[model samples]
Each structure stands twice: as structure tokens, then as C-alpha cells.
Target chain A: MEDNVKKIMHVMRRAPHGSIYTYEGLEMILIMAAYEQDLSIAFIGDGVYALKKNQDTEGISMKGFAKTFMALDGYDVEKLYVDRVSLEERGLTEDDLLVDVELLDSVEIGRRMTEQDVVIHH
Target chain B: MSHRFLATILNSDKVKIGILLKEGPYNHQAADTAYKFAEAAIKKGHTVDAVFLYNDGVINATNLTDPPQDDRNIADRWSKMAKEHGVEILACIAASKRRGITDDIMIDGGSITGLGTLTDIAIRNDRLLTFGD
Candidate 1:
């Protein structure tokens, strides 16, 4: 069967304080899409922490889960996003992030989500 | 806008669909459904442009993943599907970094763009879906 040319979007909402699996799961999908197929990403709620800067995981050293983010460029898996409201709620601004991010409010994020061929929430 | 018109517009050919994964696929059933749905759409002749990974969803690209033999390796499966097809996978650089998903070594296909790219994909695409945990 012929394949349709559509776009996929992945949204993240979990915080980093708990488990790294949530963030990692999202990473796996992006790698698959950017490297293998085609896809994109978005952030909302507590998920904004996935992009914070100077995480200082050294104190806990729980496998350095956030470090995997640097690999995005190599995989051509760009498209990092954040939730404006979520970020503000956590007292985090774009400046506090370790990587570059595009912040969107709930309404804007919702509008953007409708543009994808498929959306998977992790 | 009327539901009929909106549905027609969303379902139009010019529309591209985007899926958002807010939690880890292991914890989120919606994520699994979305992936399956995308594959189904492709088999149905629908084109899936890009699959963006932000926040917790960024973990999908982690190379260190090692799911059990019996369990479905969602990450690897997605990678294989993307490779077989022409799907674009994206990871939120900030989200990944915050969660400690750094690229000590270089991998292919994946990138570290920005949220604007997601917006561009959404605005340009026909449909955007979210599989929230």
C-alpha cells in the first residue's frame, strides 16, 4: 500500500523530579521519527522540567538521564518545545533551561497539536 | 466553524497529522495507540510527516533503552518503523537535557531543533493528535 505523507507530534507532560523513564520514552520516539521516519515534539504541565538547565543530577547521579538530550542534533530530531504556563508555575524561565526551547501556552499548544497526523502522549 | 467543515478541513489531503506524547510510552497507553495509529495511517495511504518528542516523550530516543525480551520495545519498534518508512522523529532538546538525555556520541536522523519547528509542523500540517498519559 502507498504511504501518506503526514506529520507526527509527541507531547510530554511529566516532571523530572520522579522517574526518568517518562522523558526517556519520549526520546526513543523522537529518535525513531527523526532518524527512521518523521516526527515532532511538544511540552506541557510538569513536563517543562525536561528542558531545565544545570540540573545538578550529580547529587543523585541517577544515571544522568537528561544527558541524552545532546544527541538530538546528531539524530536530526530537533523541535524542542515547552508549556508557557507550566514553566511559569515551576518558577522556570527559558533562561533557566540547559537547552534551547520554544514555549507555548495551553491554547497555542492545543492549536498546534491539531496540526499533526498523529499525537502520542507519554 | 461547523463540525462538518472542521472535520472536512482536518481530514483534507493538504493536512498533515502530528502526534504528541506527554508521558513515557511504557506508562502511557495512548502513546502506544498513537504509534499504531500512525502505522495504520501509513498503510492506509496517509503520510505522517514528523513525530516530535518533547518533555517526557523525549525519552523515546534514548539509545540506552533495553526493554525485556518478551515485552514490546516501544522505542526500538518506533525506530525500526521510522527507518522502514519515511517518518521524521524529533526530540525536544531542552526536555531531553533536563532529563539527562545528552548526546555524548553522535546518532543519525534525530535533531535538536526548537518549539517553533513544532508550531511550524502543526500550522502546516492537516491534523495534530496527542496521546496523553
Candidate 2:
């Protein structure tokens, strides 16, 4: 029922352009966000790169979607999270990201994941 | 008493499952694994409402896929399961269009649908399991 707002979390674990998973994953997220469900996104591993600042896909002939992350808040899908260990392992910090995301430890992320009604990983 | 009895049955212990497969057949084990999981669940008396195809998973709904004589036809495998078990096998329209999979070429017991349908599957089912890289 629309009355039960589901806690759905989309987990991004892949890098952009390596395959269409991250991009398609994002597309799925946007569509679900319109359902008025409680939605959240988590970036781990290479997925953190999707939010990296200054992505250039012109040379690869791919439509740049990094900027799309910034517009997600306009959809009311504001719970963007990043794995702190994943960012630091890649020598990145909050400043390296193109969107404002909550830096969460693995434990915190796992706890959030457990509370979700559904978790989709890409 | 009647209301309490109806509520008891409505809250059945069996899970209602919805599967999302993102990989194509053969190249990845996601399709096979999802099929087996669905089969096992149905055997255990659970309800497997649908299997939604996204990404290259749309490839699984095409009858044009023909493997060698000795090989397992993955497309046929899905078709058979859908026919025998009455499970809804759906492929995303946008993904299918991108891959050139039209309704005319779709395997038996499968249909082309949209992401909005996927949203329904995710919301209506008790469990939504995703299989992909």
C-alpha cells in the first residue's frame, strides 16, 4: 500500500562506464523515488568514484551522469551516503565528491542496511 | 472470529518473492541462480510473483538465442519455467529496445514491460532479490 513507505536502499558498488550497472542503477533509483518511498543510496568501493568531482565522459562518447547526482535532492531522494573507508582507500575525502553525502563507517552503513525493507546493489 | 481467521490466513508464513536479474545468460550465473532460487521457493510453497529483467537480462526473453545442440538453451529454460510454474517473466521496455528485443521475438510466456512495473514488483512483493555483477 502507498501508506507503507518502504525503506529501500540502492547500493552502488561499481564504477561508472565500466559497465551500465551504476548508470542503470541510478535510473532505477530515480523512478522509485517518485513512489514516495523512503529511499537511500550508498556508495562503496569504486562506486564512490561516481560522485567524484570533474568527471569527463566526452572522450568516451558516454553521456555524463555524474552531474545527475547533484540533482537527486530535487527529487526528494536526499539520503546519499558514502563508505568512509572506501573513500579513504581511494585517497579521496568529502571534498573529492561532486554531491553532498554523509560519510559513514561500515558499521553505521551496515546498521542502516539492516533497517531497510529492500536493498538493491549494482 | 471470522475476521481473526481471515487475518491469520492473510499473514501466511510463506514469502512472496520478486527477482531482478541484471546479467545475461551464460556469461553470468545470475540467471541460472535466480531460476533455481525461484524454483526452490515455489517448491517450498512460497509465492514467486515475477522475474523482472533489466540491463542485459532482457536478452533472456528473446527466442532468437540459440545455443549448440548439446548446450542448455537459457531462453528456453526461462520459457519453460514460466509456462509450467505460471510465473510472470517480464523484460524492461527501454532495456529491450536498446538491445533490439521486440515483442515479436520474445520467448513464450515472457512479455515486455516498463520500469514502473518493476516499481510495482518491488513494492508488492515481500522479498525482492537482485542478481547481477
Candidate 3:
């Protein structure tokens, strides 16, 4: 634990594959992970769809990076937060997600967000 | 004046901000908003350390850009703003190469740098604000 480890929270609000925002957001996260910052990801709104199980992108010709979410632990980016309401709205639970995450309400997530040094919404 | 008001006015904690622009000019309002935000931050006594252009945002640093006579030239605006404020306008090298943004086409006060620079900007700055679609 370095003294200058800044808490960086990346909030993903967009759905995967619909646009490049989520994919590119993930790319940015991956790059920043190498910096050894205290990084956390929050999936709000359609962002939860990014972690849904069994994402088949073969038909769209797009490279499926959904599995990459599971690899965040390897980069020391283990704090994955999924909005509870968002998951329920989409008729999904923790079991539907491909990776293990802390299912929290928006209030808790908002509090955690304020504690961060930087918050990037995508 | 109230104590809180006086405290706020006397506060010297000016945040060092670094902007990350991921959208291109014209197609999105991200560039325009980021430019305006940077301008406002400078005016408010905050130091805008750098503007790291990534993805399509690297296109905003090209000198060969030609906008309509009535339109505001985004590249020219960024170049002039950076020159005046001493803000480093950096475009990601990989993204630039893919988008045909060579050094010869780089605007004044702008340069092509690697993602490592972006990482440094994010780490060094007090706030790393991102503007995109």
C-alpha cells in the first residue's frame, strides 16, 4: 500500500456493444489499473448489462471483452460495485452476472463515490 | 460577509485539474464543453495541468483542420488556449497513429504522447475530469 494511492472510481452507465463507451471505458480502466491506484468500478443503469453472463458477440463481429471483467482481480482492481436497483430493474440478480460484485443501493454507492479522488462517468 | 463565505474566498486550495477528452470535435459537444470548463477553471484560479486527448479526441489537435467560416474552429481554439495558459495539450500516440494524426499535423501547444503520459497526468493532478459522449 503506497502513500499516494488515489481512489479512482469509474462509473459505467452505458450498455456494452451498443456503443463504444463501455468498451473504451473498460480499456481506460485496464490501462489505469497498471498505475496501482485504488480503483473501483460502479455499474449503474444499463452498465450492469456489461457483466451479464454468456455474452455472445460472434454474430456482431465485435470482440467480446465481457470476460475481461473477471480479470480485474489480476490487475488489483477488485472493488466492483453493482447498483441493486439497476440490477432489479433489468430483472437480474447477482447470479446473472459473470463476475462476483458487491451489490449495493445507489445511496451507498454515492457515498463511496464522494470518498474518491476522481470519478469518471462513462 | 459570513465566516463560511470569507473562508471560501480566502481558500487557496486551487485544484490541479487534468482533462481527458475522448470524443472528437463537431460530432460531439465533449470538446466544446471541456474547452469551456478548462477556461472557467483557469479563470477561477485553478491550474489546468493538461488536456489528454484519447480515442477520437486526438483529432481535435490537428492543425490541418478547416471548419466553416461561421463555425468556431475547435482545434484552433484549443491551440490558442493552451499557448496562453501554458496547458499541455497531449494526444495519445497510439490513437493518433490510428487516426492519421501525425506530428506535422499537430497544432501549436499540442503534441503526441503515449498512454503513460495520460497515466502520469491522472496521478499527478488533483482532479482528472473526463469529457466524452
Minimum summed lDDT over a 10-residue window in model 1 chain B is located at: B104-113
Whole-model Cα lDDT of every candidate shown, in order: 0.68, 0.92, 0.91
Give the residue spans of candidate 1 off by over 4 A: A1-122, B1-15, B104-108
lDDT, candidate 3, B11-85, per-residue tens: 668889999999999999999999999999999989999999988999999999899999999999999888899
User: Every model's DockQ, to 2 decimals?
Assistant: 0.16, 0.71, 0.48
Cα displacement (angstroms), candidate 1, residue A40, comes to: 21
Give RMSD (Å) of candidate 3 vs. truth: 4.2
Model 3 clashing residue pairs (backbone):
none
Candidate 3 is scored at a TM of 0.90
User: In model 1, what lDDT does residue B45 have?
Assistant: 65
Off by over 4 Å in 2: A1-3, B1-11
Q: Would you estimate the TM-scores of all the predictions? A: 0.49, 0.94, 0.90
For B31-130, candidate 2 gives per-residue lDDT tens digits of 9899889989999888889999999999999999889999888899889889998889999998899899999999999999988888888889889999
Residue B57 lDDT (model 3): 93
Error of 2 at B38 (Å): 0.8
Ranking according to DockQ, highest score first: 2, 3, 1
- TM-score of B-chain for each predicted structure, in order: 0.81, 0.90, 0.91
Best by DockQ: 2
Among incorrect, acceptable, medium and high, the docking class of model 2 is medium
**What would you estimate as the lDDT of candidate 1?**
0.68
